[model samples]
Target: MAITSANQLELLQTAEAVAREKMIDPGLVVEAMEESLARAAKSRYGSEMDIRVSIDRKTGRATFTRVRTVVEEEELENYQSELTVEQAKQYMADPAVGDTYVEEIPPVEMGRIAAQSAKQVILQKVREAERDRQYEEFKDRAGTIINGLVKREEYGNVIVDLGAGEAILRRNEKIGREAYRPNDRIRCYIKDVRREQRGPQIFLSRTAPEFMAELFKMEVPEIYDGIIEIKAVARDPGSRAKIAVISYDGSIDPVGACVGMRGSRVQAVVNELQGEKIDIIPWNEDQPTFLVNALQPAEVSKVVLDDEAGKIEVVVPEEQLSLAIGRRGQNVRLASQLTKLDIDIMTEAEESARRQKEFEARTALFMSTLDLDEFFAQLLVSEGFSSLEEVAYVEIDELLVIDGVDEGTASELQARARDYLEAQAKAALDAAREMGVEENLIAFEGLTPQMVEALAKDDVKTLEDFATCADWELAGGWTTVDGQRVKDDGVLEPFGISLEEAQDMVMTARIVLGWVDPEELASAEEDETADEEDEA
Candidate 1:
């Protein structure tokens, strides 16, 4: 049936109504209609023809046309979509390349099947428009709190109705021991918004630390006003949580402000979180002081930091040990998370015992390695001499500063230290050769005798193995294991070679072995060219 003027007006009204109901642009609905009509026309006018359709926004009048671009004879690619300038001259007096020509085609009568196909097209477009609107609306709202009703439960996950759309609260993100029935009103943090195959997925979470921080913001006026800022949060959800807060105004106590008068503000947050305990602590610029504060109520006797290893050792009184560690190590675990440091907690007695053991081990090492008496070894250990390398590198004056040590004795000790190290190196080299290490690798500039032995033990006995070793294997960066990058001990660490020297040695070995090829040279040339172009 042909769509008459009367039906065309009805079509426009229907599109407007659908757009209003679906919250999509009316223009998009009209475009969908035009595309549907064009697809239907292709059945009558040959699929190879470049057919198109357009609908007037106000009148709902649809137009069908054949479209082609005028191109030079040599530039023509498709006969249906492009026309030569001479061929296009029939449609327009003067036709040139890049000129578009549109010829109108009479409206075709629509059959029942064609009308149904058109309706399906319109429905799909409206669905896509709705999905796009939902994605745009919620994508920027991530990291914010949203109120919704629990619509239903799927498996262990909760489906939330957010008025405009639906969201999902995954099972792992729900607070422990918390359950909701249908129509229960709940507030959750929007963790993420993703566009999936089905539709936009808005992920909600009740156990994110940021969710707790946001709840505090709602409860504490000072926090909302920026007078108090939540610096960091760590949560063992539904059990306990700690928040570090700092105050911009000195007069305003950040913790007290968050606590509110009579603990009302914090209590509100606790109530919302199903009676979870909250500890609000003051933030400190110094890390050790901050860590001390983070582990509150448990007294700390001392804090020893290993900055290079990114770890902290905290010692507490024996009585406070269990309190500091908490049940199953929860307290120290939360403290580590809050401070972003690896923490090791011990009692004062344990720390003292460990220190004494280390001292004895170092003394024994000095005595046996340098052939010194127990008294002399004790003296060297007390003066902070832990290894033979330190003894060999220290100035003679430094050794003379030790008690009962004079100039002659210091010189003899230094000579003995040097001779011992030389003999040790020779022994390592002999062992490496016995293990069948390549002569070329043994002669490498940066590979000390001990390093050769280590490599040989690992079966990296050939120059090819040395050349193919990753930078981390040689100079120590990181290595991928099970798809995660972990710190590499490096072959050089045992040999006492600096990472810089290892890197230089690796480069020199690769050049000497000719591992680099012409492809690598070409890549280098391309990089230089790109740099010059960027500079120009």
Candidate 2:
């Protein structure tokens, strides 16, 4: 091969052109080419020799050099890279140890094999640069909508060409029943961007709730302008969806603005989603009010919320039960997800029956436990007395508020309630003692006589047993019968023992019994030290 004056600049021009096409810096391409040339030159010069190649940025003329360090006679370990001072003096006068010597070597004509290797190296570097550029561009664009052309499909996943890079629309992320042909325009949400061994992988989704929210933002001017904000969204993908919106300006209706004039705005979104139905509702700060709004078109007669349990009981008219529950419970399920609370739907008749049963149970409890007659028990139940504990704990004035119950009668009823509770406690204490419950466990703070008895009944009579009880076991656990797990409200349900209280009791028991082993104790001490250091 012969080098021509005109061809000397071809390498630089080619590198610049490739860098522009691949969206990379030309300097990086030149560096990669230099590395490839150095590797090829090492084949002609000895492999042990320290060889380097540098390409002139202005002329594109490559120069090859062999490097060696002048060393003392005894310090010359590698003959190729290190030269004895006597050998260095042959090349130059006053050569000293640590002095570097460079010998110009003729450029080797790149042969067929070497050219192939260089081509591979340049292609690999270009691919890596492209991947890095794509990662930098798309990493922050996640959670936003991206438009692309449908390039092809592999298995069930669709490959989308986003102009700068290719993205994957996984099967699970695609809208159900939606189909696409080659070159068809597709819109999706950028779910994730990850760097893998091959290259950067861009994951797109059409089924995410955020996709719906973004679509709304694009279609609704009020949302885009910040007059209305999207609070939450729940989707049943490609079939039905619900979005909760609120307006900062009271004069503006958030739901109406999202729905648009003549339903055109929402309809546009619907058309894009292939006719997926959407329900836009105004959001409310009050949880019950928000829940009622979330369950749209189905009137809720009453809502009972249990905040501690994160559950809501909704009572609606008999005819509205199916409507509120939707087909296969879609409406209630979406409402539960949107509100982030468990929802139980019941008809008004069912709620009335439940209330009646509860009233009878309370009346029976009062009659048997307090030894009150049917008339007195019914009066107490009507006054909202549900348990012996409530009756015993209520103030005398509260009991006196009952009709025909004067001070004397109220005092007597309270006395009987207290007596019943005392007897129950004494009986539990006696049983716990007989069952061999430890005295220290009984004296532990936060453990009631009833808890002691319960522990004894479950063979948790010793201090070690109590210390070893997990929080779930102390608070409540599903009963196991006949080798099958059976769901129970919990053995401690009647005692109203909270999980936090159970945890405190367990910790106290462990500390008193010295149940913590040396390793755990050391770890706990280390954690405490770290916390103290942080505070300081």
The ten-residue window of minimal lDDT in model 2 covers: 483-492
What is the overall TM-score of model 2 with all chains considered together? 0.86
lDDT (Cα, tens digit) per residue for candidate 2, span 1-536: 32346677998999999999999889889888888888788876777888898999999888889999998887778898889888988897899888989998888877889888888988888888889999999999998999999999998999999999999999999898988889999999999999999999999999999999999999999999999999999999999999999999989989889988999999999998889999998899999999999999899999999875567899999999999999899999999989988788999999999999999899999999878898999999999888888888898889888899998988888888989999998999899999889898788777778988988888988788878878777665455599444544544556887677777777777877776565787799799999999999
Q: Which stretches of candidate 1 lie above 4 Å from their native place?
A: 43-50, 67-101, 221-228, 433-447, 460-467, 474-489, 495-536
Over 303-342, each residue of candidate 1 has an lDDT whose tens digit, in order, gives: 9886644579999999999999888888888898899888
Task: For candidate 1, list the clashing residue pairs, or say none.
Answer: none
What is the Å distance of residue 148 in model 1 from its true position?
A: 1.4
Local distance difference test, each candidate: 0.88, 0.88
Show model 2 residue runs off by greater than 4 Å. 1-6, 67-104, 457-493, 503-536
Best by lDDT: 2
| Predicted candidate 1, C-alpha RMSD | 4.8
